[model samples]
Target: MPTEGVTGANKGIGYEIVKALCQRYNGHVYLTARNAIKGNAAACKLRKLGLYPIFHQLDIGDEESIKKFRDYITKHEGGIDLLFNNAGVSFNECTQAYAKEAENVINVNYFGTLHAVEILGPILRYGARIINTSSFFGHLSNIPSSSLRNRLAARSLTVDGLCHLMNEYLSDVRNGVHVTKGWGDSPYTVSKVGVAALTIVLQRMFDNDPEKRQISVNSVHPGYTQTDLTGNMGTYTAEEGARSALFAGLDAEGLRGQFVWDNLAIIDWYAATPPKSF
Candidate 1:
């Protein structure tokens, strides 16, 4: 069983990921999106390719919609083996970002994903896999500041600490204290950081639960994929960027709780040693 979200399957990386899954697994893959017309069209296109991918309408931000989709999945598919949290959004104008826009991005990218996991956790059978789409922009190295950058890069910082930092950062954003307090300026950056941190938390949680055999939860940076999210400024094709995701989604032989890039595992050095930033 394959589950995808925010898939404008006719175009971009989300579409490419679905195609790759169909080719590699040749199983029942769910194509999900909030827009029915676009989703069905994409499904039809894939159908013409002779890959019968199922289409489902899912708005990640809406809890009721998520439950409805979950119910449908339970009744029809029995259980899901993979859950790909690939849907997210961000505003174009980064410099002139507003609180509401930032909130919306965080809500969809961070909270929406969390909600999906919460509701779908029970249905994911043993040895299930979950891949969260994150970005290199969330990397601490990208921050140019000497102090905050060092703090973010520090080793000995636990995932819990990172979550706390992210909460504080967003709180600052909401209270208009970020700029004045010299916090990270971009909301997208902060939200992506939260995404990475969240992955670490889930991975560890799954790891500690001895009842299962490696749930294999990880985050991916779909490197510079040409999607509507990037406004077509990306250098890589959507299919190319999704290569890592394909590897993580299907290759569940011996891996779990890794942040991957280009189909290989990456260690969050800062997460391992949070207090020892370089």
Candidate 2:
């Protein structure tokens, strides 16, 4: 039987994704969150709606938590048919120092998501699907430095190289020279850009895996959703925001290494105009 999972699904767009999967997917859907109480509550709510979704505790920021979840899936489901890298954090106000804010945001949003994939990718079933919930702001055009942009867009850029770039950004932030170094002002934006880049990198790796030929990996901009992440200031509801991600996760076959817009159309990540709603 096919099995799928979503991370950070206790609430908001992630929760909506899990709910949609339970209603439409023809297999087990796991709703995961760092907080067990909230994750179970979300699962119960789905049960009330006549949809059954299993709950799992997952903290993408913690490697131990990730390994535990991977082990459970390996033991119980054998392998995952679909995985959504959705757990993330953002700061509405820059109350904290730039360096501190950048570190915390990058830890959970980029490195954390990348680590989760590293541990789980090997167990993905043949023809599996992977979707990373990136933002339109994550487009390569967000980086103003021409050299940095070109390096990121290079076809030969490897995962290690990406990690090095992210690390360099953090180092620059720590030295209070990120802006001078041509890094973006918003750490959240940079982290999501890393997520989008990682999506393509993973897709390339999957292409080399003979056992996982048909697996498609893509990043999606879930529109501007009125979720806690946005401080409820967005134009769309959580349910509406989840539509593009849900479409990509459950459908969008053969669409690997691409950036999908809120309308579910594939866009050129480097050249497309930024979505105005975000």
Candidate 3:
């Protein structure tokens, strides 16, 4: 049987994604969260609804926690058929200094997600599907630096090069010159841009692996969903936001290495301009 799993699924779009997977995916669905209490609670809620979802504690920010989960999945399920890198954080209205916020945001949203993929990716079954939950805010247009944009859009970009760029951003933030160095003001936006770039990089790596070429990897913008991440200010509900991700996870074929929008349409992240209102 196929096995699917979602990270950071204790609440919001992550929770809704797990719920939908339990309903539609013909396999065991693992609902993971950093908090065991909340994870189990969410699993119980699903059980009450006549759906079976196994709960696992996963804190993407910690490599040890990720390894434990990876070992468990490897041992119990043998391998994962579908995986979602959904755990992330943002400080939209924070009063903290930009430098501090940047560190925290990038740590969880970019590095944390990257760590999860690095460990679990090896255990992904052939023809598996992987979805990286990115955002429209991550569009390349958000970064005003022409040179940086060119570097990021380059097809030759490597995973190591991408990591170097993210670390450089953090360094600039530490030196209090990120803005002058052409980095964006929103750390959340920049970190997500890293996520989007990582998606393409991962796809390239998969393409090089003869056995893994069938695994489709794509990044997606889950729309402006009303969830804790948005402080409930977004237009779409969490359930509504999960549709695009669900579509990509279950049915997207020949759609590899693309950035999909909430409408389920693929957009050129490098050339496409954000809506005027965005």
- C-alpha RMSD of each candidate structure in angstroms: 4.3, 1.4, 1.4
For model 1, the stretches where C-alpha displacement exceeds 4 angstroms are 1-10, 94-97, 142-167, 180-182, 263-278
TM-score of 3: 0.97
The lDDT ranking, best first, is: 3, 2, 1
What are the per-residue Cα lDDT tens digits for candidate 3 across 46-116? 99999999999999999999999999999999999999999999875556577778888999999998898
Residue-wise C-alpha lDDT for candidate 1, range 1-278, written one tens digit per residue: 44433333445777787887777774578888878888889889998998877889888889998898889988887767888888888755654657777778777877777778778777787778888887876555444455655555444455557656666666878899877656656777767766766776777777777865457788877777678888876767887888777777876456566667653556563542222111
- Provide backbone clash counts, one per model: 10, 0, 0
What's the CA RMSD of model 2 in angstroms? 1.4
**C-alpha positional error of residue 43 in candidate 3 after TM-score superposition, expressed in Å:** 0.8
Ranking by TM-score: 3, 2, 1
